[model samples]
Target: MIRSHFDEDLKQLHREIVDMGSFVETAIASAVTALKSYDVERCKEIIESDKKVDEMERKIESQCLWLIARQQPVASDLRQITTALKIITDMERIGDHASDIASLAIRITDRSFFPESEMIFEMAAAAIDMVNSAVMSYVNYDMELAKATEEKDDIVDDYFNKVKHYLADVFSTQPHRMDVAIDYLLVAKYLERIGDHAVNICEWVHFSQTGEHKSTKIF
Candidate 1:
């Protein structure tokens, strides 16, 4: 009976993490949309939604601790809970980056000042896909999917470099738009960081499944 209860608790923890992941995915998507549209109201909404993401992280963390203290989970079970603890930290930071992007979006005075590079939008899309794949890997305990998701980080990085070059060209020719150029650069940087966090989550998923921390050297 005790084992059954503990198993059920673990299942509940999984559901909560999935819910948190869903919230973060929405935050990032909305943030990028707001950036493109110069929608301050939507940006504010993403910022406000971050609080709920944080709450979800705290709740899952509490559950993990309770399982460790009360159930004395060991081996795979302990790894699973501890991996969740680590994963949520990454997930929470992903939420923060989304909020950071939205904050930047709100500060821009000229929407037309943004560069014409399509790479920024592509970078956002890649990061969002990585986050989604990482979370799904955790939910399904699929190591192969986790590995593929980690590999996708490279695409985001490539997009980041392209955006940097594009921004540099814009800055060189249009020195008066320096501030606007820098703002867009920072947005790209945030998206790059989000991709890194997604890679971290995938690493945790790999560890949870295999009990080995996947080397990020390849990343």
Candidate 2:
């Protein structure tokens, strides 16, 4: 009976994690659209919608705590609860980074042809996809899918580096644009960091199931 109860609660936690993942994905998509179209209202919308993601994170965190306290989980059960804790943390911070990107977009709206917007969007899209797969992997214990996501994360890094190297060239030739260039660079950096966090969540999920860390902090 206890095992059944724990299983049910784990399902609820996983569902909430998926919900949060959707919100994060939406935030990234909206942010990129706002950047491309120069829409301040859209930026504000992203900022306001972030509240829902925050609430979802808090609710899932509460569920995790309740499970840990009431079920007194051990072994893999304990790992699941702890994994939920870490998952929410990374998800919430990813949401925060999305908000940061939106805010920066608002500031740079009048600037001409903001640097590397497409590459940054591509990075965010890849990260969002990985975050989605990571949550699903946790729910299904799909080790194969988890392993695939680790590779996709490398693709995100490649795009990230491409933007970095391009920015280096831009700044060297057009030093007067340094301020705007730096802003765009920071947005790319934030999105790359967000991808790293998503990969971290996948590693933790894989670890929770296999008892081995999937990411060795190597990539």
Candidate 3:
């Protein structure tokens, strides 16, 4: 019956979701840096810190459940609560991919070899932007920002394909580096997967507003 209560609870929900997004972005950044520098120490830190992100995800999920049970949030409010639940799941999986990339960085202990970090950098940049836009869209209920994030996802996908092609060339011709090449290729794949998850969040944001996925172009 109290409107103020619903407003405050939803505000808190936004804070928790934004905080979780920040954690995912930081994990992705650290993982990319670990690969670029071949720094085992940083990679180890990434692996250790992944658990904190996991806990954050659990807390947000619990909050979403509490809100659903306590308040009969109607229509748009119901959609928002469901979207928050879905977004956290995608965010948690993205953290796992980040951890996977960090583990690959740990494999190159002795060699100074690093794959072309620029491609990873590009992917990371697009991913971060997607997260930023998606978070903002969620906070403001801005459908445009949410819709634009899908375009950035395409850019990250292109960079991922390029990295895969270059990795294939290295493995076939410079066969001596096959082991390290595989590691780098996996890192790229993980980053690409993380980007996909980010796009998924954006899709959910759009769905919460429009009631249908924007990605499904309708006639």
Candidate 4:
């Protein structure tokens, strides 16, 4: 009976984490959409949603601690709960990055001052894909998917570099637009950081499945 109850608790914990992941994913999407549309109301909505993400992280952390204290989970079970604790931290930071992007978007005074860069949208898409894959890997306990998602972080990083190069040129040619260019670059930086956090979540997924901090070596 005790084992059965513990199993149910673990299941509930998993469900909660998945829900948090879903919320963060939506936040990321909404932030990017607000940026593209220059929708101040959407940006404000994303900022407000960040508090819910924080609450989700605290709730998950509490559940994980309670499980460790009362259930005394060992071996794979312990690893899974601990991995969740680590994953939630990364997820929370991702939420913050999304909020940061939205905050930056809201600060733009003249949207026409900055030229559109395709790389910005590409970076957002790449980061979102990585986060989605990482969460799905955790939900399904798929080590292969986790490893694959981690590998995609490089794509987002590459996009960030491209955006930086383009922004530098904009600053040189259009000094008057420097402020807007810098704000766009900051958004790119946030997206890059979000991708990094997704990679961290994938690493935790690997640990949860294999009890190893690193994913399986790829030759």
Candidate 5:
């Protein structure tokens, strides 16, 4: 009876983690949309909605701790709970990055910023996909998918480098647009960090399955 109850609690934890992932995914997507449209109102909305993500983090974290303290989970189960703890930290940071991107979008009111906006959009999409896959991997215990998602970080990184070079050239030619270019650059950097957090989640997923992260045995 106790084992059955613990299993059910694990299922609930998975559902909540997926819910948190969805919240973050929406934030990233909405921030990108706000950036594309220069919709300051939408950016503000994303900023406010980030609080829900923070709340979800705390709620899920409490559940994980309760499970650990009460269930006295064995090795595999303990790993699973600990993994949840680690992944939520990454998810919360990703949520913050999304909020940061939205805040930057509001400041980037310069119409001339559109020239390189497409790259930023693509980068954000890649990061969103990574986050989705990482969360799905945790819920489904899909190690292969987690590994594949880590590989996708390269795509986001490449976009970041390309955006950096393109903006540098633009700033060199049009010194007056320096502020706008820097803001766009920072947006790209936030998207890059989001990709990094997704990769971190995937690493934890890998550890949950194999007891290894980046090929190093953690336990």
Candidate 6:
């Protein structure tokens, strides 16, 4: 009976994490959309939504701790709970990056300032894809998907480099646009970090499934 109850609790925990992932994913999308549309209201909304993401992280942390203390999960079950603990931290950081991007978007008053706009949008898309796939991998316990998600980080990195090069050219020709260019650069950096966090989530997912993170075996 206790084992059955513990199984149900784990299932509930998984569901909650998936819900959190969905929330973070939406925030990333909203942040980028607000940037492109010059919608301050939408940016503000994304910032406000970050508080909920923090609260979700705390709640999930408590749930994982309770499971560890009460169920005393062993082997794969213990790895799953531990991985949940690690994954939430990455998810929370990703949320912070989303919020940071939104905050930066609000700082740039000139809508016409972003000539590297297309590259930035592409970067955001790649990061969002990583977040989605990482969360889906955790939801289904699919190691292959987790591995693939890690590979997508390269795509985000490539876009980040492209944005930097394009912005450097802008600065060389139009020194007056430096301020706006810096803000856009920061947004690209945040998206790059978001991609990094997604890869972290994938690493934890890999750990949960194989007791290995990247190439190193933990268990």
Among all windows of ten consecutive residues in candidate 5, which has the lowest summed lDDT? Answer: 111-120
Model 2, residue 11: distance off in Å is 1.7
TM-scores of all candidate predictions against the true structure: 0.94, 0.88, 0.90, 0.95, 0.96, 0.97
State the TM-score for model 1.
0.94
lDDT of candidate 3 at residue 57, scale 0 to 100? 85
Give the Cα-based TM-score of candidate 5 against the true structure.
Answer: 0.96
Candidate 3 worst ten-residue window by lDDT: 108-117
Q: How close is candidate 4 to the true structure, as a TM-score?
A: 0.95
| Candidate with best TM-score | 6
lDDT of 4 by residue, 1-219 (tens): 769989999999999999999899999999999988889999999999999999999999999999999989998889889888999999999999999999998997677755566679888999999999999999999988999998999899999998999899999999988998999989999999999999999998888877777645321
**Candidate 2 C-alpha lDDT tens digits along 1-219:** 757877988887888887887788778778877877879999998988889888998898889988888989888888777888887888888888888889888888536644456777777778778777876776687878878877788888887888888889878998888777887888888878777877777787787776677544311
Screening candidate 1 with a backbone cut-off below 3 angstroms (N, C-alpha, C), the clashing residue pairs are: none
Which portions of model 5 show Cα errors greater than 4 Å?
A: none
Clashing pairs in 4: none
* Clash number for each model: 0, 0, 0, 0, 0, 0
Error of 1 at 215 (Å): 4.6
- Candidate 1 Cα lDDT to native: 0.89
Q: Taking the tens digit of each residue's C-alpha lDDT, what string does model 3 give over 38-142?
A: 788888988988898899988888888898898877788888888888899998888888889889878855344444667767877787677777777777778
Per the 3 Å backbone cut-off, how many clashing residue pairs does candidate 2 have? 0
Model 6 bad stretches (over 4 Å) = none
Position 116, candidate 6: lDDT: 50
Show model 4 residue runs off by greater than 4 Å.
215-219
RMSD of each: 2.6, 3.1, 2.6, 2.6, 1.2, 1.1
The digit string of per-residue lDDT tens for model 6 on 1-219 reads: 768888999999999999999999999999999998889999999999999999999999999999888888999999999998999999999999999999998998986866558879988999999999999999998989999999999999999999999999988998999998999889999999999999999999889988987789987
Report lDDT (Cα) of residue 118, candidate 3.
72
Candidate 6 accuracy as lDDT: 0.92
Q: Tens digit of lDDT per residue, candidate 5, span 1-219?
A: 767989999989989998998889889988989888889999999999989999999999999999988988988898989999999999999989889989998888785645657778888889889988988888788999999999999999999999999988988998988998999899999999999999999999999988998999987
